[model samples]
Target: MADQAISGDRVSGIEDESDLKRSITGKLLFFYVLGDVLGSGIYVLIGSVAGAVGGAFWLSFGLGVAVATITGLAYAELVTKYPQAAGAALYVNKAFKNRPLTFLITFCMLSASFAAAASLAQGFSDYFSQVWELPPPLMIGLLFIVVLAVVNFIGITESVVANVVMTVIEVSGLVIILICGAIFIGEGRADFGKLVEFNAESSPIMAILAGIALAFFAMTGFENAANVAEETIEPQKTFPRALVGGMIAAGILYVLVAMTAALTVPIGTLAGSDAALLEVVKTDILPVPLALITIVFAVIAMVAITNTCLVALVTQSRILYGMAREDVVPGVFGKVHATRRSPWVALIFAAVVVGALLAIAGQLAVGDPAPGEEKTTALEILVNVTVVFTLFIYGMVIVAALKLRGKDESEGTFKAWTPLLVFGLLANAGLLVYSVINDPTSLIWCAGLLALGGVLFLLERAFDRRRSESV
Candidate 1:
């Protein structure tokens, strides 16, 4: 009954009569997924992966793709079944019907998006600083967040097109790295054996698992794509293909890029630098001009950061819009601009949080050292929280998929394998364990965030009761 033959296209789920425009085709949706999935994660997290697994960093990325695939399949099933916005939070609400849990999941997702946007803003500042001296990086980073917020408020169609352009620019950087590695190997200066070598840090299995925990963060932007399903044309048909195909493409690209990085540069060198991918190009192995290549890297790095930030803002605002519609949050968040049809109120709120976080990261980057503190940047702390909360959200989504299975047999044509759903649950739960073991600080940060969600939920309930009494 859900799959009505609407003009023979086999539409499932209620058609969205929202202000959101259905301009996203299968091709545009493909680019959207490709762009979001191929975000700053690979550009920024490669060094961390190398630090954990040494030269065999590709293994971690490979495992990350496998883990992401399991969840991606679950997402494909649910997004098509629901074919609405709000993504993971919506799925959670449908399965459990628990307001508190749904609020927590939704809040955690918003927190993750703000943290991710801040991280990307800081990344943009770092790369821009490489090209020109920034007198105050914090101010520059806040400016970046502001720019993204403005774009997000304009319209979804415009935002996705910008993402497509930026995606092309960012993917070019990876292609160049691969070509440089090929040239290096041809000259017999690269060590092909390092491709399989793991340093003496720990057992190989533990190292790969550790690396997978970190690498998993790089593959997460795919899930956020579900938030835009409402804007997608024939979402039930296109979402599953875009979500799964995009992940596969990004996974292959990640593996190839990781192998090239390990083969072309020493693991120690790659592990030490935050801008490790740039090192591959600037190395003597490549005959390109150092200044030209550095500038190119700087430009592409900014593009990557901006692309990810834009997509994050889009999803975060949509999640807020979805929550507001459900009365899980303030109704103001659901308001769409009359002309642009964008979630302007939600965009403003998301921007304020992201901008504040960026300012904090900027201060942490430049402020004088505390007496004995390790001088960690706010971006570093927030990225860890983002990873932890993201895994938490993913775990709940897989559970929701299992619970909702067969409940609506006609809701979606695609069904995730039950075994894979179980695997996804274990994998996400295992990653959460690894995250806590590796960085216990994440547990504290996530706890604080969840507590804030609880407080907000109670406030909303009280306000709703007050309004009803007045009536």
Candidate 2:
């Protein structure tokens, strides 16, 4: 097949008009990845990770960085090499030469994105309710999705500029928590030795590995960065640096926050509290009034969730638009707005799916709350599903990198280290197996979703054949 020209109006010849605007510069791309990588994962996954790894929670997060970096290298190489909007699905199609497989990978990315958006919506609603009484969480979550979709339909540059502002505010919140931890240490109220403590029930290595699997959930935003390649200016020259730099910066910041959290707060206390980071802030070290601290924490949590959902929705819509261009799904998804130059149809479709997931998941969990807990908390379940799907996607992407390693570097492309690619493959495979063992229900969800993708793939294929014969 011939490659498409780089016309502003058509994204890979899929649209009749010009495609998404190429306004994202190197700096904007950096913040986009940084803000997205530092998203709801830290806000929601920290406590869950602490529960798994005890006081040595930093170890798990560090390990997650290492693993994410390995996979990130694969993404960097592939995104620069292809420089398209499809991301993993595009690489898979190129390497494997299988249309059905491509559709499956594309759908997995979209579904995982929806899961992330849905989980973040619930988080937003949960925190919003803390500040003010609200209607049912499902309604609030749906409303948030609708609002995000509107912002997305407006323009990519506008969406990403808003993200940069949110990213700064969110990072500032983490900085405040770090300062509070330092104050506690100066007062000699906390034991720094606790930073190395491991849970007595499990061996140290086993515990850290378990924590890595959970921590890996927070490390996934880097791949979504690849989905925006088509919208970035000079992606081949700009994406590799931004992607790797953003991941490394986010990892260092995460480790610092995890270490400060471990040293300043009791593992048991942090593990048990849903608002674990808030607990660190509300400690006497900050010297803020209780009501003021509560409001600050709520606002920060809402910003983190909003940043996450916004990025996920953007990535999901682009993936659908990419797949639509290939006839893997309906063509309407590839329809770009004539004036706005955005994938308006795909944007609305993604928002509706995310809203439905949030509504259904919230209702299901609400019906089965544990005593004293406000709800049954299916957020972790949704997060788990995303992790599983992402792991498989990561595995395939690494495989694609290996498959494409032989391509020339004449265009400034380079291959990741073979050992790192192998290691990433093994790590992803191991984590997928472990996740299935721990939460078998996640596999059922993955299976059902993949099956849905298969049905759509067959339909699109048949439709293409008929259209060709008619022509």
Q: Score each candidate by Cα lDDT.
A: 0.81, 0.81
Query: Candidate 2: worst 10 consecutive residues by lDDT?
Result: 10-19
lDDT (Cα, tens digit) per residue for candidate 1, span 1-471 = 433445555545565454345788888777777777777578877877887798898999999889888899999999888887778888998999997788788899988887788877876776677778745667778888888788778764365567688788878988988888889889888787898889686889888988888788788788878767877888888889988998898899899999999988888898777577877887855677889988988789788877878889888887778777878777788899999888898899888888876775566557776897645555566677788888888999999999998776574458988987898899999988888887797678677656755665676678889999999
Model 2 residue 189 lDDT score:
82
Candidate 1 wrongly placed segments (more than 4 Å): 1-22, 156-160, 284-287, 337-341, 359-378
Question: Model 1 misses residue 354 by how many Å?
Answer: 1.9
Q: So what's the TM-score on candidate 2?
A: 0.87
TM-score of each: 0.88, 0.87
